[model samples]
Target: MGRYACVVRPSISLVVPVFNEEENLAHAVAVAGRALAEFTSQYEVILVDDASTDRTPEIIRGLTATDPHIRTLRHDRNQKLGGTLRDGFAAASMDLVLYMDADLPFDPREIGRAISAMEVTRADMIAAYRYDRTGEGLRRAIYSYVYNGIIGVLFGWPHRDINFAFKLMRREILEAVELRSEGSLISAELITKTKNLGFTVQQIGLDYFPRTRGRSTLSSLGVIGKIFRELIVLYPEMRHPRRRSPQPAVRPAEDRAPI
Candidate 1:
């Protein structure tokens, strides 16, 4: 029998959005290799360099050269985190998708956990929840409070971390919810929008860790202001059911033109 003739199993596409984090990229890749390879051999790891001004793009190129499974997409202009994710998601082609922070704050073992949960529950989405908060004092507390409170009140909680980066999702769910929030708060935007569509999703508690390098992009003033804006702007979509969820609707390169 040909290799393609066996019973087909769904595969994973791990999408890691990269900015200017040269220091942390290698560690993230290593963890992915250790944790994800056991699940499915037909998987792909997509690294997106969102027009990093630093060595991030170079680092990504190096990884791609050594690993055929590692695919990369680069943006010419510096798009923020959300834009990077949008670009990354568009390029992905797999049955299952995994998106996470490259800084190594969340546990990678949760990849196996999330996939297992999806298989058992047949849930469209599996989100990773932090059992304990990492990082330091007030910033950690404030971030948790702001996002958790907003998520609980605005959307339906019981899910503590709406913005948790580690998520395992089906291609249908990923395609259904069109991702657009082009900044740090895209996680909240994704969770709320997905819940509205009735995706049968669940959260699994996870181990959190401290970032040893690469400064966080979230600022005290910037984050808070953005939160309020999201509540006002993005909240209404949650109020009423949208006709359909976001999915991939791609066009030829020639079609995307100024003319």
Candidate 2:
């Protein structure tokens, strides 16, 4: 923590999306809360539960009662990653918003470094890329590499990791853009729109930690199918996104003759 003593410590809303994460939610929130307290006193952890059928809801109730900094949002039914994040981001009311997985894919203490990076770079968003992901297994590593390369080529926005679950952004960035993906493509959608809208985005490298509790499902066939479906439907809109405000219309050529 001493190394992060210079962190700017902006008020942050940590948005975690969980579904059937009874094994990880409680411990994850507690750990994240402790890490957040290290740098900033003004912070809140919003756990958006996508109608988990396990004991997760019970655990969330217990956590909310025990931790004042913890709050939660519930969905009547599962909404996958994108919808869950959209609701969570909408609920965030802080200067900064951080999106991480309930499984705690990376060290929460690294959050301070991200804040410091944001401050140093003056970027509107700080997206983290895994320094090394071979820990997750070779298959996942290959999948991620191919996915990132394809995204970079298609979107013309090359990034180290577009779908990694570590994105720190300013509240204004969320307010300025409308995110519409209901699946894994949401991350790509977010980064693309942020860049398209003329916001500075910076990336930092962090040690990756694969989930040790519960099964990993984001790479399932169904989830990957949904990602492609959303990408196809949203491609045009993302490429030619409407500006937040209408640009000044150029006067007719004759009207500018005196210039």
lDDT of 2 at 203: 95
Assess every candidate by TM-score.
Answer: 0.85, 0.92
Please tell me which predicted candidate would have the highest TM-score against the true structure: 2
103-215: candidate 1 lDDT, tens digit per residue: 87776766666666776666778888777774556777677777688677766665677766788877666676765676766787777767777766788888877678997
Point out the worst 10-residue segment of candidate 2 by lDDT. Answer: 250-259
Indicate which candidate wins on lDDT: 2
Candidate 1 C-alpha RMSD relative to the actual structure: 7.4
- lDDT accuracy of residue 159 in candidate 2: 98
What tens digits encode model 2's per-residue C-alpha lDDT throughout 96-188? 899999999999998888888877777889999999988888888898899899889988979999999999998878877888999999999
Stretches of candidate 2 off by over 4 Å are 243-259
Colliding pairs, model 1: 175-246, 175-247, 176-245, 176-246, 177-246, 178-246
lDDT of each: 0.73, 0.87
Query: How accurate locally is residue 2 in candidate 1, as Cα lDDT from 0 to 100?
Result: 22
